[model samples]
Target: MEARVEVSPEQEARRIAAVRRYDILDTPPDGAFDRIAALAARLFDVPVATVTIVDTDRVWFKAAYGLAGVTQVGRDPGLSTSAILTDGPLVVPDTLQDPLARDHTLVTGETRARFYAAAPIVTRDGHRLGTVDVMDTRPRRTTPEQAGALADLAALVMDELELRLTALRMLRVERELVVVEHAARERAERDRAEIAAYAATLQRTLLPPALPEVPGLEAACHYTTASVRDVGGDFYDVFPLGTGRWAFFLGDVSGRGAPAAALTSLIRYTLRSTALLQPDPCAVLRALNAALLSESADGSRFCTLIFGTLVPHPAGGFAITLTGGGHLPAYRLHPARRDGPSQALARAEPVSLPGGMLVGALRQADFTSRPVRLLPGQALFLYSDGLIEARTSRGARFGEESLAAHLTHHAATNRALGAAAIIDDLTVLLDSFAAGPADDVALLALSAATATPTTAPSGASGTAHTSLPLPARHSM
Candidate 1:
C-alpha cells in the first residue's frame, strides 16, 4: 500500500510541478502573503487559511494564519488538487458528494475533512504557481459573496508573487550599475546645495554695496531680512544722478522667505529700470504700482514705497522731494549741542506722509509728496520700522523718539560715523533684549546745508507743502 494518499498520481505531479517554478526555497515570510491568508479565513469563515505551495513529496505553506503550530501538512490533494490542475479557479461546494473524493484519505482519514475550496494562484506568465485555499472542518455551502471574496483574495496572492519576481529582476539590474546610482545621488545632492548657495549670494548682491556720497551731507542706512534662513522681500537704494543731484527709495513687499525674496529682486530691478526711464519721483512710483496691480492676478499684492529725488541748491545744500506711500516717516536731526548748555543751530521733525489706501486694493491710486532742504550741519534720516522698532534683549523697543534723539546727537557728525554709532549701540541693545530679531531693518540718512521751505515742484510754485494723501491700502 503506497500510503493511500487522496491525490492522484497526475494531480500530485502537477502540484509538485507548479511549486518548482517559483524557486522560493526557504524564504522568510512577508506581510502581503500573510494578509491574504487572513482575509481568506475571515471571508469564508474557515478555521484555517493557507497560501500553500504543493511540492514533489510534501505541501509547503508560505503563509498560514489561524492554524496552530503546524506550518503545513503533506496532505493528499485527491480532490483539493482540482484547483492546482486547472489553469482557472477551482471551487468545490461540497466534498461529501464528489465521486473522486468520497473515499479519499482526506474524507476517511483522521482529520475527516468534509469541505474544500481552493483558488489556483497563477503567476503573470500563465504558470500555476500554487493555491490560495481556505479549509473548513464542517461540510458547508458558499454564498455568491463568499465566492467573489475568495477569488479576490486569490488574485491578490498572484499579484504579490508577480511583484516579488519583478523586484528580483530589478535587483539584478541594479547590481549591474551600482556605481551609476552612487554618482547620481551625489550629483543630485550637490545641485540642491548649489541652488541654496546661489539664492544666498543673489540676496547679498541686491543690497547696496556702499551708501551714497553727497558732499557735505550726512547719511546712514541699514537693511535686514526678517527670515535669515531664506531670502527676503525688503530693499532700499541710494544713487547719485551724475550731477550734484541724487535719487533714492525704500520699500517693503509683502511676504517673507523665498517667494518674497523673488519679488524683492523683481522690485529692485524694476525700480532701477523705471528710475532711469522716468525720473519724476511721483510718476515712477505710480507707474510701478499700476503695473504691479494690473498684471497681477485678482489677489495680486502691492508694496509700500517712498520715492525721492534730490537736487543741489544754489546755496551749500541739497533739496529733497519725497513722494510718499504708507511708509514710516524719515526723522530730521539738528545739532544737539546743549550737552554743556550751548544752544544748537536748528530743530528736528519726523517726516509725515499722505494718508490714503494701500496700492493694489483699488483701480486708481494716488500718492502724496513732501519737500525739505538739508543744510550743512543738518541731517535727514530715512529708516524702515525694522530699525527704530528693533526689539532689545530687555524686551524694549528702539522707538522713534530714541531714534530722533540719536539723530540729533549725530547730525553734525559724519554720515558713516552716525550709522556706525547707531548700528553698534542697537546691536548690543538687541542682544540685551533677549534672543533674536523678529523683523528686518533698513535705513538711509542724508545730511546737507539748510535751505528755505518754499522749494516746491514746478507744477506748484506756491501751493501747500502736501500735494496728495498717503495710500493706506498698500497690501501685497
Candidate 2:
C-alpha cells in the first residue's frame, strides 16, 4: 500500500510560470551547479544526485552527478514532483516501507530508488521552482544534519542562476554601445572629407587663373599649402592692368583655414579694384589698408604685402616700382658678364623697399615706394615669410642669410637657369630641408629676357618671350 500524493492545479500553474521566468529550460550544464550536485551526493551518501527544474510534464536536470547518462526523468506523481509542491525539505526514508513511495515508478523500475531526499528551490516571492535531490538504489534514511546541508546547496544553485542572468544582460548592453560608437566615427569621417573638398575649390578661386604675358619679361610662380583639409593664408597674382602696364602682388593673411580664405578673397578683389583706379604702388597699398581696417572692427585681421607695378623702359629693360607693407625684402639675381664667358659667377642682392606698418592696423597708414631696374639677364624673387621661417631636421630656422647663400650658389653653378628653373631648384631645396613643410609658401620670380632680338607674335607687344604651363597644386 502507498500513500496518495495530492495535486493542486492552481499552485502547480504558478510554479510552472515562475520556473519559465528564469528561462533556464534545456540549458547546458554549468560547473557551479554540477559542483553543488556532486557535493550534495557526497554529503548524503547517495548514488544519484541532481539539480532539477520541475516543468509542466517532466523534471529536467540542469546538472546531475552519479546518474549514468541520465539528464531527465518523468514527473508522473513521483517524489521529485512532490518536492516541488513543498515549501521545505521532503525526505523519504526507505521508499519500499514508506506509504508515499511504495508504488512509485522510481522505486519499482530499473532505477529502483528506495530512498529520496530533496530541498525545494524557492524564489524570494515564496514560489517553488525546482529541487536539489539525492536518491539511492538501496533502502536508506537521511540524518537531520544531512538534510540541512542539502537545503544550503539548493540555495547556492539559485545564486549561480542569478549571476548568469546578470552577465548575459551586461553583454547585451556592451554590444549595443559598440554599434553606436562605430556609426558615429563613420559620420565624422564623411563630414571632414566634404569640408576638405569645399575648401580646395574655394582656395583655387582666390588666385589668378594664369600669369599674364608681360612684354620683355619672363615670369613664374608657385604656391604650396600646408594642409588640404584647411585653406592657407598665402596668396599671389600677376595680371595685366591695361596700357602695357601690369600689377603683381604677393601677400599672407593673419590666419589659416576657412576664415582666412574668406578674408583672402576680399583682399585680392580689393587690391585689384584699388590698383586699377590709382595705378600707383603706394596709393594702391593705402587703399587696401583702409579697406582692411574698415572690415576688421575687432582688431583681429591684418595682412603683410608687397605690391608692384611694371612698365617697359625706353633705355633697356622694364622699370619696376615696389611698395612694401611690412613684407619680406625681394631679391634680384644678376647674371654674369654677357660679353665674357657664358657661365660667369652670378650675384644676388636684396632689393630693399621702404618698410611700413602692417596693413589694416591704422587709419592713416603710411606707404612708400622704391624704384628698381630689371635689366636683361636679371631676375627678381618675391616670397612669403614661410620660406625664411622653415625649420630643418635639427630644428634650426632657415634664416634669410642661408637663403641668400643658396641663391648665390645656384646662380654660380647654373648661369642659364631662368625664372622658372630658379623656382624649381628652390622648391627642391626646401623639400630636402624638412620631412614636410609646416607652413604655407608662395614664390614668384620675374626675369628680364636676354638681349637676343627675335620677332614678336602677331597682335602682341614687340617682345619675344616663352611661357610654361602652371604646375599642379601641392598639399602638405
Candidate 3:
C-alpha cells in the first residue's frame, strides 16, 4: 500500500495562485486544447481524457473527451487533485490494487475508473496547475513511450496558455488607454480649450510616446501641429522585432480630424501586427495597402508612407532596407571623410523609390524597396511632405531643393551630426516661420554616433518634442 501525500497549506495556496494567473479557469471551449484532449484519449487507449485545471474547490475541465455532460467535479472526488500533488507523471496500473487510489470516488463510484494515468501540467516556476489525464474502465499498464508523450502534451498546453496570457495583458493595456482618452474627452466638454485639448489628446494616442533604445544607434523625433483646433494625420514609430532586428515607419494620412485619426490608428496597428508575421519591407507595405483598401468603400482613402527594417551589420554599423509608398524622398546625410587636408562638406542625397506609388490609392500599386548601409557618423533622415509644402514668412513655398540645401548647410557646419542635433536644427527652422508650418510636420532622424551618450536620453529622443501652442481660436 502506497502512503498518501498531503500538500501543505502554503504550498496549496501557491499552486492555486499559479492556476489563477493563467486566467483560464472558465474560458470558453478552445479547439486547440480540445484537439489535444482528444488526441490524448486516442493515444493512451483510454475511455476518458481531459485537460483539467484544479481549482480551489473543484477540477474544472478545460477540455474533455468522452466525458459527456460533465464539466466539473468536486476537488475531493477529482483524481487530478492528487496527480497535481506530484511533480512527475502519476500512473495507477490498477486503482483497485492501489490502496491510496482505490478509495477515490472516481474509482469506486459510477465513474468506475479502474486505470488512471496523468502527467502534471507544471509551470515554468515549478507549480503544478493540473493534469493531462486519462482514465479507463479496465486496469492496464502505461508504456514508457505513452508516459513521455503525455508529458509532451502537457508542455503544449502550457505554451498555449502563455500565448493567451500575453494577448490578454495587451488587451488590458489597450483598454486602459481607451479609458484615458475618454477622460480627456470629458475634460474637453467642460473647458473652453476643448479643441486644443481634444486634438492634442487624440494626436498623442495615434503615435508612440517615445522611441526605444536600439543598441549602437542614436534616434530622435519631433512633431509640429499646424493648428491646435484640427488634428493632423502624421505618425511615426520605431520598434524591435527580436533577434537584433528593428522596424520603423513614418507616414501621413489624407485629410485631418476624427476620420484621419481613426485611419492613422488602423494603419499603425496593421503595420505592427503584419510586420511580426512578415518582416520583409515590401511584403509589409503590401499588407498595409490591402488593409487600407479593404476598409475603403469607394477606394478614395489613401496615405503616403515609408517602412523599413534595420539589421546590425557585422562590420560595426547597420544595414537598412527602406520601401517608399508615394512618399517624398528621404535623405541620407554622409559626413565628410577627413582623408584629405581640405575636408569636403557633408552631403545630403535623396533616396528615391523609382516605382513606388501612393498606398491605398490603387489596387495594383507597386512599392520599391532599396537597401543602404548606415556607417559611422552617417544619418538617415525622414520627414513628412509638410516641411517641403510649408510657406515662409514671405509666402514662398519651402520646396524640396531649399529643404535639402538647408540640411546640407547644417550638416557641413556641425562636426558631430547626431540625430538630436539634426532634429534640434530643424525644430529651430520650424520656429522661424512667422505663422508656423501650414501643415503638420513629423521628423525622424537615426544616426550611428561614433562616440558619447551611452544610451539616447528619453527626454530628447523618446518623447516627441512639439511646438504646439499656436494662436488660432482660444476659448479658455
Best by TM-score, which number? 3
How well is each residue in 1-476 modelled by candidate 3, as lDDT tens digits?
12345778998899889988999998899755776787788787787999999999998999999888789887874378788876578888898987667888778878799999898888899888889999999999887777877887787688667656765665566556656666757665434345556676667666676788887777889998877767898989887765698899999998999989878876876676556547688888887888788889456778999998998888866899999998888899987767669766689988888889888988888999999898767899999988988877788998999999998987788776688889999888877876667788999998875644444432223435655645652211
Cα RMSD, model 3:
10.4
- Residue-by-residue lDDT tens digits, candidate 1, 1-476: 01222556775556456556555645888655765676678767887788877665555688877656656555465544446666444555566777765575556755465777777776655455667877777888776556656665666676556545544554445444544545657777555434434444545655665665555444455554544235555678776654566778887777766666556655554555455446677777776676566546453576776778888777766688988777778666665445467766444578787673455445567778778876544566666666666665466777878766655555545332233344444444444544344566665656553333223211111100101111121111
The 10-residue segment of model 3 with minimum total lDDT is: 454-463
lDDT of each: 0.59, 0.74, 0.80
What lDDT score is found at residue 271 in candidate 1?
Answer: 58
Q: Give a tens-digit lDDT track for model 2, residues 1-476.
A: 12333557886688788888788999987655765776677777788889999898888899888777777877855587788666578888788876767777778877788888899888877777789989898777767666766776776677555544544554455445545655757877656545555555556655664677777777787776667667789888876666788888898999988789767866776676556546678888887787677778655788998889999888767899999888888998887666656755687899777657678777777887889898866788899988888887678898899989888877777655367778888788776765445677888888777666333331222211121112223344
TM-score of each: 0.49, 0.56, 0.62
C-alpha-based local distance difference test score of model 2: 0.74
Clashes of 1: 33
